[model samples]
Target: MDYHIYLAGEIHSDWRDQLRASLKEKPGVHFHFYGPQENHDLSDAIGEHVLGEQPNAVYKDLQASKINNLRTELHLKKADLVIALFGEKFKQWNTATDAATAIALGKPTIVIRPESLHHPLKELSEKANVTVDTIEQAAQVIDYIFA
Candidate 1:
């Protein structure tokens, strides 16, 4: 079965590259890299490695009323799991939103936090199906979910 995984992390952070590499080894997994559009080209990177498909911009326009609708629709249409990268930052709104949405939708969700971070992703960690602190641990979570 195909798994659509939503990748949550700080834009422009090195973690995105690591995530891309990790997911590349898991062939059938498709990723939707979510974050502020200006800071990074995560979607493009994922597209290059996977199917070269991008999210629908017409649907993702950020007007307050439409953004959540678009996100929900995308989740319904494309996601089976949500993988959040909680790096140096404790947690960001987008990460919270993605994890919450995934939980509400009954999708399997994992939150990965770097141990170096000062604060924990307490709320997300509490809700996540699994939580880890390293790329290796994250890969193990993926293996568990996809195996």
Candidate 2:
């Protein structure tokens, strides 16, 4: 059986690319990255706002739409487990929400935070089925548990 892992983390281009490449090495596991097709250079935001002006309602609506879409993709259908990757800082606004949704749905969840000592989503992370400090460790746990 194949395992579906929803990878959530910071949006920096290099970090994202590196993590994706690393996680893709896991055998029999599929990694899904949210918003991979979107432009990450703030171009999308700039295009949405003319002359640096965006309506608050428009922003809220777009965020809601994105969140709903993530829920549909990550929780309702695709993900067998959720993995939130963190670096030095734990900036997990949307990632935390997705993890919470996965837990609420009774699916397995894990957080891979290597550099963080105090995570903002500490409570939620602790409540997950398991938590590890690295993607490699997470992969090992997955293999052992799902083997």
Candidate 3:
């Protein structure tokens, strides 16, 4: 079996890398990952790089997020599953948006976030197929999928 997974959410950490490594190889199983730019610099400046500078921060962010959505939508549609992280430090509303889109597209979703966010994210988590508080726990789910 083969799986296409989308890793979305806060970019303030390298949890994606950890998740990728944690997935041990299963016989006859393969995994493909798709997501936003991992490099913070490029990810943050993509709009300015592609569309030139905006007049202000709000305009800049608007343009960047719009551009980024193109890739996010494409991958979400192709993915068999989506695992999103909602970190404590950054207010990554984009993570919520991507998870919602994944659910809308009928993709199985695993939400990985801190316990501190549980209450506020309850509604969204209720929609997810599963929710865990760590990348390792999320990896365990993927292992179960391909097992």
Highest TM-score scorer: 3
Candidate 1: give the clashing pairs. none
The pairs that clash in candidate 2 are none
Task: Count residue pairs with overlapping backbones in model 1.
Answer: 0
lDDT of 1: 0.62
Task: Give a tens-digit lDDT track for model 1, residues 69-126.
Answer: 4644575446676777766654466666667777788878878876665254676687
- Our model 2 lands, by Cα RMSD against the true structure, at 4.7
User: Residue-wise lDDT of candidate 2 within 25-106, one digit each (tens)?
Assistant: 5566555554322344443454344344446857845754564455445443467777766666546565666667677877
Weakest ten-residue segment in model 2 by summed lDDT:
35-44
TM-score each candidate: 0.63, 0.64, 0.91
Report the candidate with higher lDDT, 2 versus 3: 3
User: All candidates: CA RMSD in angstroms?
Assistant: 8.1, 4.7, 1.5
In order of TM-score, best first, we have 3, 2, 1
Residue by residue across 10-52, what tens digits does model 3's lDDT show?
7777888899999988989888899877777877788999999
TM for candidate 2 is 0.64
> Which residue runs does candidate 1 get wrong by more than 4 Å?
23-65, 68-73, 89-91, 116-120
Which residue runs does candidate 2 get wrong by more than 4 Å?
13-38, 41-76
| Count of backbone clashes, every candidate in sequence | 0, 0, 0
